[model samples]
Target: MLHRVRSKVYADFVPEFDATSVAKIKAAGGIILGKAVTTEFASSDPSPTRNPWNLEHTPGGSSSGSSAAVGGADGSGCAGSQTGGSTCRPAAYNGIVGVKATYGRISRYGWAPLSWSLDHVGILTRTVADGALMLTVLSGADDHDPGSLREPVPDFSAQMAEHDRPPRIGLVRQYYQDYATPEMWAHTEAVANLLAEAGAEVEEIPVRGGPPVNHSVRAADYGPRIRAGMEMGMIIPTSAYLKAQRLRRQFRADFSEMAAKVDVVMTPAMPAPAPRDLNTTGDAAFQVPWTAAGLPTVVVSTGLSELGMPMAVQFGGPWAQEGRVLGAAQWCERIAGLNQAPPNY
Candidate 1:
């Protein structure tokens, strides 16, 4: 995927895989499945893959093929990447599990950067367990990625054990109630209520002032950063970049502080399910804050939309808390009882 995108005629000098990363994947006993399609540099542009549920609609991108390959009618459990809502949106659109691990959890040594500050390496799969398995194999710090954290990797798969007691979950007050579609919001609320009824402590929590505006600015400005690197032969401006970094730190701190009181934060994965039109990808507003904070986020399909398209809720956890996040997501998956492969491939 990296090689092909880098070779494109209009390729704008994005990152590419070096031999060392490929050697490492092989050395780790990983085999290459065929590459999945991505949006240009994993940004806003939509791709050609059709949603398995309805071929006339989009499958979502920049990880379009990965999600379709996994949750499409074939029932092949596959993995894909997410930066903003790439994995989660498709998971919601196609009815699957997509997890965007905390930034630096997976090595960014090989991915083409959409935004150095906001980019995350993630996975899309048929179930939370499948997503967790892929995350275990893919995650770990790498010297090649300066942004990679040196923290010890957790055993995510082991954390899948079902608990007798329900988890304490928090719903960000504004996300579902305000920004999401009525059907999407209703499904998320229903899941929360189900968790509560099943012995979980589910409650609303305010995010205070909400996500930083500069985060979006930084994401949008990344194109210029990549272009500047190519044209001027200079690195990105540290001061400008660091401002976003500082905001990221603030978001992480705030999110962690909130997570101290809750096992997981839940909200609709996207404002709605897949839109019928293929000309544009849907919103990323619901995903940006979590991405900027570098929090572990999982998207679990609740079920079909009013239009019978798929929809999902996102679960987020504190840094390095992917195990708890995945476990909670798995629990939700089992309880929701909505896991089903898309109708047509």
Candidate 2:
């Protein structure tokens, strides 16, 4: 029952016990929802699951099925992972709320490894408040995972308050503007303005140097859109891997110098709406840098594209600062006020 379908390679395999995430959810009185499909080995291959927003479009992957489940299923909440935008991207494509907290904040025991250094457990919920609640239940130390944080988990739901301070937002527009479609770029700008109007202290904080290139470099620089998860692990030389990690540290260091300045860094969730092609999942480019820096990031759906597809904006906060990030996102989500099911397209 725990098989990760791979053309009979793992068809007969079953786990001795539930994954830590599943066990925790059950402990919190969450009824098991059974398994949802991810891509084969949670990689490049697209799954049979269709986007609930538009049957012809992709829901995004390798968490595409999980995204579709949450965005489309009635009274559903889903969980997925992001080694590189797999969780949040799919959630945006399917028009739902996606939150990936700071790396190592959530335990990864029993999760099939894509990149242990980069993988993060993410949740897809319909509201930011729900995301905060789940983070509280799912966070804390795990002896099974050395990377799990040992710090006492805070009351995440309490952090959801709209209390005193207006958030200070940094507008990041480099890679995002370069890659985003025209409509998406304009939408992002408009949303930034809307947030500003709502009293957020928004400002253009354009970054110039030292972007996180290590994660993609380790993923073979993403030259070709293929699922090289396992291949990346076995084939790359130790020296190259070590060098990438070093550069990753530099990226994190450079960002930390500025992360303390902004309550949240804003960007479009994805370059464009879910593409019509099913051969590939939507791009992970926009989501990658934050994931690479291991910053807490969340995607809140803004509305639909002209083609009636969903669009969203991503809000990333300083490392280990999920509280501020999620709170700001909840404020923005309320101001946008455009949540809806897939329209009759």
Candidate 3:
């Protein structure tokens, strides 16, 4: 397979070994369906992958091709990466479930780096159950990846149907309300009401921090070297990068303290439905903080926009609690009763 991070620099390049996740899948008798497209070096550049729901709209980027493939029904699941919402953003735009495992939860042995500290192996599937199953199969300790989790991988499939009565869902209504379109936000409130009437303990919550992606990935691991002589800007001081890392850890701690108050935290998966322009992917503001904090998050499509584009709700829990997040997401998905699929292609 070509190891081009969507750049011509390594157009003809082939890797000596499959990425850790790919190798794991292959060993488990999974098929290597061809590679999907990504943004240049998994950065902001928009890829050619179009939204399966609407050709004019974007299938959010970095993981654009993976999401488009699954959302269009060409594939059941795909592995994307997220530094700043690359995975869930595309999955939400495409009307599918996307899971970003906790930082170091899944080994990243051979992924082309966008940001070493922020990159995560992302899973996109038509259902939360499928996403959980993929997460189960792909998760484990890896000798090659120092960052790989040592925590035991449980049977996420078995945990799908298990929920402890009604969940205590902390809804981030006010913070996200400002970000999402009024229609979409109203729809979310309706969904929350629906869940509450159905027996969930729902309560509105507020958060303090905003986007931290601008301070992320001060040095793109292995990514910058491949780009070679591009004149981006002056090199950042190592001290600044360390400071960012420290702040990220503190943010994670703060987020965990807040998350401990509820079963899972909820928000609009995207600010709005997929935008029409292909020049840029949809906003990552909602998903960025979670990524930075190294938290596990899952998004489930709740309904369609007026234009028939997909709108989704994002669920997250404390770090290393993917099971909690996934379980809650599965419940929300069923309650929403929206099995969204793009128009036949």
Candidate 4:
């Protein structure tokens, strides 16, 4: 299924042809269910879709309806696009699984671009296994997309099932734990313990990256940071952009080295649960660094927060290593077993 924000375009605005990603789905015999509600241009502007857990809360964007439909009973699954945290954030909010495949892993030919450099085709599904299947089908190079990778697509389903031993998990705690709520911190620690008990090697690791992305400019507000980032993007000098790109490459190198030592890096998907207020999509701090590095990330519902909102943990692997991350998430999902329906569902 497809989902777009009403504010970004007219309800009847139809594209002339299917995006490469959507066409692939059709080739695989998958039906196009329908479009879900997205924020304007998949931006920070809120969409009409509300959290199923609580109508007053945000379902997240710009994949608001994509995640909502998966968590609730609307559709089998949906395709979501992310520039910042559009896909994973909503999946985290709605208590499902979302995968942000490596940049260029999936063709973005027909999808509307948010940031040409940052836009990534993401997958949202009810389980890690489901997400893996979708990724395998959606990934490939397209001549139309210059950024699409020419790398061979692996059998993710088979690889995800190949693990016989627990995988090593590196825990990034510096900024994630420091910025997260107390309850979130405790919950994350509990997950770590569970993983360790399952025979996985869980160790605290200091990330070489400068700082974890907090995105917020104030104590509890993220609006200023979001707007500021957009503003800076508009006026950013070409030289400055190049310098930033170089630094991003360095960060990716550093992270890949870390991933070489561990099967995956674990962090909170967000600093907190989905906010009750509808004025915003929750923070993207925890998901940004990985996204910026063009690494693959998958989020699985860990449990519920105090307000009964979904709290999720994200696992990131080296570029093109989505299968490892998905395997770890599948293991965690089985351990957590968080399959409860929303209160009003």
Ranking, lDDT, top scorer first: 4, 3, 2, 1
**What is model 4's C-alpha RMSD?**
4.2
Q: Which of the two, 1 or 2, has more TM-score?
A: 2
For model 2, what is the alpha-carbon lDDT of residue 160?
Answer: 62
Question: C-alpha displacement of 55 in model 3, angstroms?
Answer: 0.4
RMSD of 1: 4.6
Which regions of candidate 1 deviate over 4 angstroms? 1-31, 73-79, 162-165, 214-244
> For model 1, how does the per-residue alpha-carbon lDDT over 29-136 read when each residue is reduced to its tens digit?
766665666665665566677777888788777677777777664444454556667777877778888888888877776656666766677677777887777777
Q: Decide which is better by lDDT, 1 or 3.
A: 3
lDDT for each residue of candidate 2 in 7-82, tens digit (9 for 90 to 100):
2334567878877877888899887665777776566778787999888999898887778877885445777888
In model 2, pairs of residues that clash are none
- For residues 148-191, write the lDDT of model 3, one tens digit per residue: 88988888777656752467899997668988899889878887
lDDT values of the candidates?
0.72, 0.80, 0.82, 0.83
Who wins the lDDT comparison?
4
